[model samples]
Target: MTTELSVILAGGGTAGHVSPLLAIGDALRAAAPGVEITALGTADGLEARLVPAAGYRLETINKVPFPRRPNAAMFSFPFKFKAAIDQAKAILTEAKADAVVGVGGYVCTPVYLAANKLGIPVFIHEANARAGLANKLGARKAAGIGVAYASSGLAGARVVGMPMRKSIAAMDTAALRPAARAALGLDEHTPVLVVTGGSSGAASINRAVSASLPAIAEAGVQVLHITGAGKGITDASGALLAGAGYRQVEYVDGMQNAYAAADLIVARSGAGTVCELAVAGVPSVLVPLPIGNGEQKLNAADLVGAGGAVLIDDAGFTPEYFATEVLPLLANAPALAAMSAAARAQGRNDAAEAMAAMVLEGTKQQSTGRHPKMGS
Candidate 1:
């Protein structure tokens, strides 16, 4: 008798977490044809909108973050956590999930514990080089683990790379360069530099890039600067520089065009951004966010160490850095070509398929009462 397969993807809050969860969901659906996939998230997270928009059922749970320090919230943490676990267990039962796939977020904590309590296996995917609290806790009981970077420090974590969207995964920069450039109102034969800071813009990057835009334009390269929503031009904090061949926008919905048209990219070193840049084969200067556990630094290490990209500290990412380092790189065709090649070599476009297969394999093993495979 064939056992019907069902899955619960527990991840949310940020796009970094939600995107991978959706990719895995898409992969499982494609691979199994009739697998029932449910997403466990919070109503406030991006997942609430993204998950349902992706055509998957989303079950929301309470947002009970793990406290780090002594506080009243910390004192009440156990009760809140228990409540989340109870809610997760109910969702898991309703979905009749065969496996719980966690992409790393607060929602995963309870889902992981609940799945383990129910004797159902958990699969984890860590998107950062520095593992988060949720993934660290989930890893202990997880049947299998996948990491985006080799140095993620999760025991038995296999480097699966980041699961990128289909548009980015299938993009051919050279073949689509002309059309992409046209779509962005860029000139053919002109090198285009696309600068962005993900969904929420980075102030440091914006200020530095904006200040250096005039000089950058003098270098004969066009700039596509996406300042992000709510961080528009005319802001006192970070103003835009108006110049010929300089295009500024708050956001771009279809980033494939931006990536395709770009000869070089300037952005933060978020795991998703790093992976997307590598897969798109666009050379970049990565500035890791100054906050957090320096995961962005580790996320960009593979490409930077491979000579595909450059790393600059947030403090050092100044207008002078842009003029002195970035402008010259834009002028050097051979160096740019080499960097692009290195980025492509470092990227894995089949990561989604590989991760999907791993989840299914782990599920099958769990059902058969056999030991799941471990290690990279």
Candidate 2:
């Protein structure tokens, strides 16, 4: 009798990690009908909700963050980290996990250590152009390492691309354009620009879009502005701002429709956003968040290099920039088409399946008493 293949997907905290985790889970299930998939995350992380909502069991552990400097937490870090590792080991043992796939988050370190201790194969996927500390440590002994960017800095990592939602990955933009425009109440004949700052929203992008609404309308462009939740643009009296051809919503549950309806996108250069835009063949103006370790800029490199996107720094993505750069680009159909083609060329919709295959293959090798090659 063939025993079922059991796998543990580790990572959480943010949508960036959880999104890819869920995608890999779905792909694994698709590839192996009887595979058992469980997710490891903290109760407070987004995975606590998204993982279960996606129909996979989630195992919770206390978040153990590595302190950057000497502090109280750093002093107690050893005990906390050990406890988390024990919890992970218990979960993995109970699940009989044949392999662990991590997408990179605070939760991954303990899980990686636990899997290593238990002698289970570990597969890692790094979503950022620059490797996160957790992933950098986990990659040391990972049986397979997959990265969304060529410059991820994980030694021996394969560029498998970001594992994205099926809604965006399997989207046929051209076929869905008309219905998507109608659904969003946008005119099919007019150029449509979709603006978003992700779920929590980007204050800078929101401010710039609000300031450029009149210019956007004057350029015969319809705007679908997804202001991050509760971050809607308002006027002096606190009335929500409105323009001739602009539609505002606090959030969009699924982005496929928005991508289909968009002739152009102006948004942050998050790893997920960059990959999704490329997959959907949507041209974009990417404004890297002017903070953090500059990973957002690194994440935008491939798409920008591919000529699918134009990168603008956050400070420069103002109303003046929009008028001089975006409006002119909106009027140029040929440029948009070329950008779309370039974006598509850089897309890898098969990333989830590719990662899934690696996990299963590594698991099979472990079961056969044969070691899988690293980075294979």
Predicted structure with the largest lDDT when compared to the true one: 2
lDDT (Cα, tens digit) per residue for candidate 2, span 6-108: 7899999877788889999999999998888899999988788788888999999999989988888998999999999999999999888889999988999
lDDT scores in order: 0.87, 0.90
Q: Which run of 10 residues does model 1 get worst, by summed lDDT?
A: 367-376
How many pairs in model 2 have backbone atoms within 3 A of each other, for residues 3 or more apart or on separate chains, i.e. clashes? Answer: 0
lDDT of 1: 0.87
Clashes of each: 0, 0
For residues 17-119, what per-residue lDDT tens digits would candidate 1 score against the true structure? Answer: 8888888888888899867789999999888878899899999999998777888899889999999999999999887788999998889999999999988
| Per-candidate TM-score against the hidden true structure | 0.92, 0.92
